[model samples]
Target: MSSTTQTPEATVAVVGGRLVTPDSVIEGGVRIDGQEIAEVGDIDADAETVIDADGQLVLPGLVDLHGDDIEQHLQPRSGARMDASMALASADRANVAAGITTKFHAISFELDEETDRSPELAATMTDAIVDATDLLVDHRLHARCEVTQKRCVDAVLDVLDNGDADLVSVMSHIPGKGQFRDMAAFRSYYENSSNHTAEEAQEMIEERMSIPMETIRDRINRILDRAHERGVVTASHDDENPREVERLAESGVDITEYPITLETAQRASEVGMTTAMGAPNLVRGESQWGNLATIDGIEEGVVDTLVADYHPPSLLAAVFVETGESLPERVKRVSAAPADAAGFTERGRIQPDKRADLIVVDPEPTPTVTEAVVAGQPVYRADATTGESQ
Candidate 1:
């Protein structure tokens, strides 16, 4: 972040902010030369465009590795479906406004999913995400594979081979395992998440439990193999045991998303995998499903990245959560660490010659994204106080 850059020479410059670099924070500005960061700190030359970042914090834009907010956008209300393009647009704006420049939309292919997330809908959204070019943020796909469903496994494989999935994760959420270690909790989660009645939820849980462990492992292995072959980052969801984490790490998994226990998270870190937890968990101080707290993971040095999960804005809020760390360290969990976890190298840190993806944050009463810039372009601003500076 603190690089020895040349004299300021660029088309656009953001001036007068506490620039949070990797090493330290400085009261300076950043110069953007087209699509790259031309210079940082001590800019004196005039430019055609200038964003007045006075009294704010200028940090690299967040790179969210996984979020399911797109699904929420698609069905904002019950029993209704929005257009694919519209949903993508809304989600893009939401993420960018939340200071997220790089987003991995987690689309799940599951058996007992709601009506809005059919196989055809998943395919449509996949194509939509790929074909979209007018988005403000860099949108990528994270295909969530529910391995108990053959259709889900097959769909993820096709998407992976076609180069549509940037990140792939294997999810086997059968009862009495992982996130649902308690049988009563499994029934409650299934009954609440779908249209299934109590009896139906029980039946579905029993049916899923009947799926042989061998078959589930086989399906997960196939997905992991293809993901490795395609050179895409792979993740295991809601890991519960150290043994399971070790097995996934041996298989070359790059990340472990939301390990349910501290032991599992430590095992993931010991085996050389990036551990990610939900930003909301950090903001709310606990997991939504009564699992390991994100603060515990951060304090234990087990978690390396913070994802949006279902709440896009929580990422920005979590940054200023008083985690007993410097702002630069907390910022890296959402930006540099996540970018590295996802195998991206172009735009995480605010260094010279890196992609000029940045955000100006107002950290007073609440942490809010005042302006967001992606690829050297000013894509969003909270107000009109961003133009030429004298």
Candidate 2:
């Protein structure tokens, strides 16, 4: 949660844009001196660069706490692979175009024999992400450790100890609970993703379930301890029940990600833990796999942040879909809330002396990003006709 180096002694003013603040949207301008916001509201100061935003809404750049879209860019096909550094550079541009100035790439340490998400590959990707100094946006790693993968615990510890991970989330994907509560859905997912037959999937599930709960707990605690030692944030994923939520909260989990039911989400909220739901779930109106609807969770006042999850662009669109709340309130779910949850307090809002990570969106007919400025530097500008970043 460190601020980027300030933009060299250059002043840029975004004029005539509707500034979306925490409580209201004011029709004014923002002045950026160096990398921090120098002034906001009715700025009339002469600046070296003036970007006209007459017909756009200037909001804080989106902060995505968890996004796995980079995995698609890295390994588009089952056997096909792209250079990790090249894929990370592409991911940076794509995220900035989607108005995401701060993002945490969710890399998995689930070294299953049936898939390519191995520990070695995860390490390589982590190094690539860390070495991507040319990226236009701030990038971090969310090391998703599959607790059931006992052999991968050392690998997860290595990443945490090496300072490659900013956040660590422990996930237990045992069948008959959590995301795969429905056995039928579990079978379908396993078969479709791994090309396994029903019998093979069932056998795999049985084998995974055979691992002792004590073993799983020990592995998870080890990961959490290492994360704590490194001062990295920790979260629990796919919490299924109130008991599980309470256990994770008691274990000092900072956030609860994708709680499967309203009761579970409520439990997390009651325990004062931040709750995160997927933006795609809100936009799709339901969970792709059978689970609590994100919109419903939002209505119930349980969800605190909205993560892009699999679709980076869905973050902005999800803000518009939340018509019940004001634009400022809805935008926080994708920006300030997530940033604060991830311990990034400097760049989530438009305030004086804060990092100038902002985006301008045109909300006529359909909401689209017109320009994205990160740390006072304009990184992505959309073509007026095609709406693609130039």
TM-score per candidate: 0.94, 0.96
- The models' CA-based lDDT, in order, is 0.87, 0.87
Candidate 1, residues 1-390, lDDT tens digits: the string is 011122344377899889999878999999988779889999854877889997699999999999999988899887788998999999988888889999898988875554455555777888988888867888898999989889889999999999998999999888988888888898898688766688888787878899999999899899999999999999999999999999989888889999999999999999999999999999999998999999999899898999999999999999999888898999999999999888888878889999899999988777878888888878788863453211
List where candidate 2 sits over 4 angstroms from the true fold. 1-6, 197-200
Name model 1 segments beyond 4 Å from true.
Answer: 1-10, 113-115, 384-390
Give the range of the ten consecutive residues with the poorest summed lDDT in model 2.
Answer: 1-10
Q: Could you say which candidate leads in TM-score?
A: 2
Once model 2 is optimally superposed onto the true structure by TM-score, how far is the C-alpha of residue 91 displaced, in angstroms?
1.2
Task: Give the alpha carbon lDDT tens digit for every residue of 201-306 in model 2.
Answer: 9887998799999999989889988888999899999999999989888888999999999999999999989999999999889999879999999888899999
**After best superposition, candidate 1 residue 140: deviation in angstroms?**
0.3
Candidate 1: pairs in clash? none
Error of 2 at 115 (Å): 3.1
